[model samples]
Every structure is written in C-alpha cells, then in structure tokens.
Target: MPNSPSAKKALRKSQKRRLVNRSNRSALRTNLKKARVAVEGQPSEAADDVKTAMRHLDISAGRGLIHKNKAARLKSRLAKKLNAALTES
Candidate 1:
C-alpha cells in the first residue's frame, strides 16, 4: 500500500530489521532462561551462563533492541541470584 518510493523502501528495511530483531530477541530469551535455570542448579556452572546472558542483554540494549534500564535490571537480578547461589554453596 506504500505509493511513494521512499515509503516502499522504508517498509522493506523495517521488515528486514524486524526479522533480525526477532531472531536476536529469541536468542536472548533462550540465554536468559538457561542462565536462570543454571542459577537454580550450581553456582560454578551458573556463573558462565549468567555472564553470557548479561552480555547479550548489554549488547541488545546498546543496539536499541531493549531498554537500557531493563537490561540493567535484568543483569542486576541475575547477578544477585548468582551471588546468592554462590554464597549458599
């Protein structure tokens, strides 16, 4: 329905971007889930997954895919869980 050339190009670009963002977001969610489950298991093993998830969060936030504050909060909570698990073990 885009009559203008610029609008058509913009729509194309947005569709491409949407696909990329969706893939990245899916990966991020998977990482976060793994990290969370790991945190509930063993401290030593969980640390690496938590670090990976945090890295993904930071990268996604920097790329403007997610809010910086949301990223920070998730990282903080994950770090806290990791620390608690570490202390308990």
Candidate 2:
C-alpha cells in the first residue's frame, strides 16, 4: 500500500496508464492479426491492411507500448509475405 499522498497519486496514475496501455496493445495485436490474415488471403487486400498495421505499430512503438525493433521486424515480415503473395499470384 502507498503510505504517502504522492505515492498514492502515483499508484493511481500507474493504474490509468496500465489500462490505456492494455487497450492500445490489444488494438495493436488485432491490427497485426488482421494484416497477417489479409496477407495470407490476398496480396491486393493485404496492402491496405499492412499499411494500417504498420501505422499502428509505429504509433505504438513511439508511445512505448511496443519495442521499435519488434515493430520493424513485424513490418519486414509482413512486407516479405506480401511480396511473396504478389509474386505467387
């Protein structure tokens, strides 16, 4: 338990931040999943999803919700999948 008033306030702020981060993280994961599914389904459809997902990833990374390197890696993998799908079709 927080003993000081400042500590109590800090705890409250932390809880709020945690909730916000959780919501944002959930959104990010959902966007990533949508992108992956679209990439697996059709290259044309995947383009928009990938772009949206990448945008979300960038925002999340910038906000410290996710690691920048992981975001870059995911974007790379998505692009690779998109390229492969385009070539295959």
Candidate 3:
C-alpha cells in the first residue's frame, strides 16, 4: 500500500514499465529461438540467423535489458557457430 501520492504514481509507472520490459524480453527470447531453429534446420541460413540475433542483441543492450559485454559474447558465440556451419558445409 502506497500512502503517498508520489509513491502511488511511482507504483503505477513501475507496472507499466514492467509490462513493456516483459514484452521486450519475450521478444528477445523469441528471436533467439527463431535463430536457433533456423540454424538447426538449414545450416546455410546460419549467417542470416546470426544477423537477426545480433540485431536483437544490440537492441536489448541499447535498452539496458542486457549488459554490453554479455551481448557481445552472445553475438560472438552465435557468429562462431554460424561460421563453423558455413565452413563445414
């Protein structure tokens, strides 16, 4: 229970922000899953999947949902997988 007016307002804002953040996080996960599926189904599409994953990673990092270094590392791993698939093919 927020007794103060400002606290009530903050609570309301927090709820809204939570909803938005949840959607963004869900979207990020969805994109990652799509990329993984694409890579598994068609190795040739790994490059494109990596591109999409990297774009989503950048967006997540820019919005402060994920750390820049974490984003970079994820992108690096995805890129590496993509490159390996390409080389193997």
RMSD (Å) per prediction: 0.7, 0.7, 1.1
lDDT of each: 0.95, 0.93, 0.85
- TM-score of candidate 2 versus the correct structure, residues matched by position: 0.97
Pick by lDDT: which candidate is best?
1
**TM-scores of all candidate predictions against the true structure:** 0.96, 0.97, 0.91
Model 2 lDDT tens row, 22-63 = 999999999999999998887777899999999999999999
Candidate 3: TM-score?
Answer: 0.91
lDDT tens digits by residue: candidate 3, 1-89: 99999999999999999999899989988888888777767879666766888899999999999899998998887777777777777
lDDT of 3: 0.85
Off by over 4 Å in 1: none
Cα lDDT, model 3, residue 75: 83
Number of the candidate with higher lDDT, 1 or 2: 1
Clashing pairs in 1: none
Clashes of 1: 0
User: Which run of 10 residues does model 3 get worst, by summed lDDT?
Assistant: 40-49
